[model samples]
Target: MSAAVTPAARVERWFFPLLPNSRIAVLRAAIYLFVVVDVLVMVNDVVPKASAPAEFYTPVALARLIHLPAPQENVVLALRAALVIGALVAATNRLPRLLGWPIAVGHLIWVLYGMSYGKVDHDHLALVVALFVLPTVGRSHPHDHRADERAGWALRCIQLAVVATYTLSVWAKIRYGGWDWPSGATLMWAVERRGTFLGEHLVHVPELLVLAQWVTVAAELAAPLVLVLRGRALGLAVGFYLSFHLITYAAISIHFLPLVVCWLAFAPLEKIGQRLETRPVSLRRGHLARRAAAGQAVAVVGHEAVQPVPDPAERRDA
Candidate 1:
């Protein structure tokens, strides 16, 4: 004897309930970190060279990846700035659902532009994917004190995207490099050949290199299981992924924002906020107390206010 549910009602019922209250806070923190990192990277790009040459702009590379026409100079500049600013705003949770799409799209454009310039770093690929997915989710707003309905959907999307990148990367290595990735010495060879920053140090230890290869395979193969794992299992899996990224950064000097973003996966946002709240209230009150003390009056409990103590010189004069 239940009444039929309307399409709108059904959608809302399914979507809203699945939304995690902590997701907004976690996502907001992630976005803020991302914005700071991105701004630093952009500053590195712009400050090093006042005018980037056409080759450095990488338009053709971008065009191939994004399937868009090569943007003119003015368009490229505008898009780059937009991506940085949009991400900053999005990170702060300002007009999230409304601004997310444009910011995401704009960041993609900026990523493409960078790739087109000359180098397409693999670390950047993960960031491109993260940016692509960020707009689709909801982040918590400090002002509103309410979770956005769409944020729940976005959280699922981000989780899937993280898994997909790992799965696809493994697939790519196998498809392009062949299934012998685990057994063969190809990974070690890659490390030895591309021994830039950390690679140079690792090349001396064959055992470390072998360990790295096996761990990489295991992490990639196990990535899909993250979605099913909950609580501690999920935390361990996320930690493994982070370790993988940390190793990669050390070995190759590659910076992967998605891996950093994936830190949110392990973070118990609610628990973090709860622990933060446990900090001594007196510490915070001390600031206000100091300010009040600076003024001429002191207010005691049950009393409105009392005038400041007169100086010894003033008392002597009186």
Candidate 2:
């Protein structure tokens, strides 16, 4: 007579087979790329003009929000540097639990300081929400391969916020620009008025302009539903959103880091991590051989040797 395999054993066999892969490595690389690009763009835009007359900060706005006096230019610059360091740490998944929240908060403060210069835009709001919520989520360490439950929740929250941004924008367009938003020339005029890189060129191609306007409306209107779909569907939706942002960047010169970072939420980061762990040299050969020998020795006693389960989740977070 034989006993059935335990549920845990069955689960280990089905879901966590031992195999070498590079999914996590790829995802980590992607994250690093995004962070590096963001940092470069920020430096190019902010550093050269930091001391210019137009780059001044206003104290009244800070007092209105938190009832505290605004710091001087030197203090703000120091905080901005700290914020960049924190963002880099978070992107690398180094000391995530300890550094994530402070980095996020510091980013918010830095943005607020920038906004105090009599200039604010809708694109900046997404970053604020992302920074505010990132600290409450997962801790990425070198040894833990499994997704932290809190981190997963944090990603989900970020997704919801992204969806809301699109939904509200669509609503505003309809309310303020009217139902003719889909077919009307309002979006075209708005882009033209902005006079950004692609805006003038886009207006020159009437057919392309019409297509862009309609697609923007369609994408924003469907954003909520698009976010609800998981896995590959979500991936596609995120790609679409990325296209939207890229187009905006080209056309309107908008600087929205959160919209770009949101793409990470759609990526299969956990699966990527699992693949990376398995691709390295296997130290299990000797152990497996010894175990097999022991099993053969036990066979004489009328019992089979049970194989050990592969637990990828046990690996540390990268």
Candidate 3:
């Protein structure tokens, strides 16, 4: 019998699974869409805050490191304009290399400038990586749905970033909240500060809050398993993760849409794209058999192709 696959081999496959460029392109489009939406709609409050008194400008680590100036009204307006316009241009994916890097840098600056007031969100970790990686990868084509290692590499980076976002969250709890975080003190504090309707009621159950704190740690730590999961297993993991975010939103006022979109890294988006791109049943019946025959011819050359369902007549002939 052949030797069993090693853990290293499994990890290699997990990070480097074959995926179509179209899927990567689709993911890029989705990420860009969310970035635009966040700047335009969701985080509109940040724009106004940029005009806050220079005394209110409290820079984060990155901003301090980069020595970003205090947000003057005109400066903030210019940065905001650049970020929004750059995001719009990048979303179109025309001249990605030209627009992508500037957009990525501008976005980081925009987020940092806004975050300078006080709070800094970690949700955009994967988004930052996604924007940078998109410019590096070759443009994905529609009809050319083939497995690409380069495309997979870019996606794998985002996947690792997403996983790190969760797994590393535990470290933050330990560092700041300390080992007693499971005692529900942090939850109590957070709820007291900004609890929503669900959080308000749940605050009464300290024991349940304690249980939830531990559960969050467990779930976040288990996030890396999404890489190893396949097919239905992956779908289940996706649902669980999505539900986790939804529950957080329902209970607390925190939103993680940036992180949520990054979970597309683990999704079978290529298959979804294939399904959506599928021709109509009647049209497919007429043309698919011919392509199937041609595919067989190409397969003899050891070229792989995505096969559609065979027509009833074609199936009967076979």
Note the Cα lDDT for every prediction shown.
Answer: 0.61, 0.58, 0.78
**Model 2 C-alpha lDDT per residue in residues 181-202, reported as the tens digit of each score:** 7777755777777758668877
TM-score of each: 0.69, 0.64, 0.80
Q: Residue-wise lDDT of candidate 1 within 1-318, one digit each (tens)?
A: 998989999766544435445556656657645755664563235323225544454455447665765546667566666766766767766676677777667666555555565555454444555555555555453323345566555555556667777777778778877757665776468777665767877778777776667677778778878876888888887877888787787777554764567557435565555455546554555644665655645555443333455666767999
Off by over 4 Å in 1: 1-22, 39-67, 117-139, 142-149, 196-198, 205-208, 272-318
* CA-RMSD of model 1: 6.8
Model 1: weakest 10-residue lDDT segment is 42-51
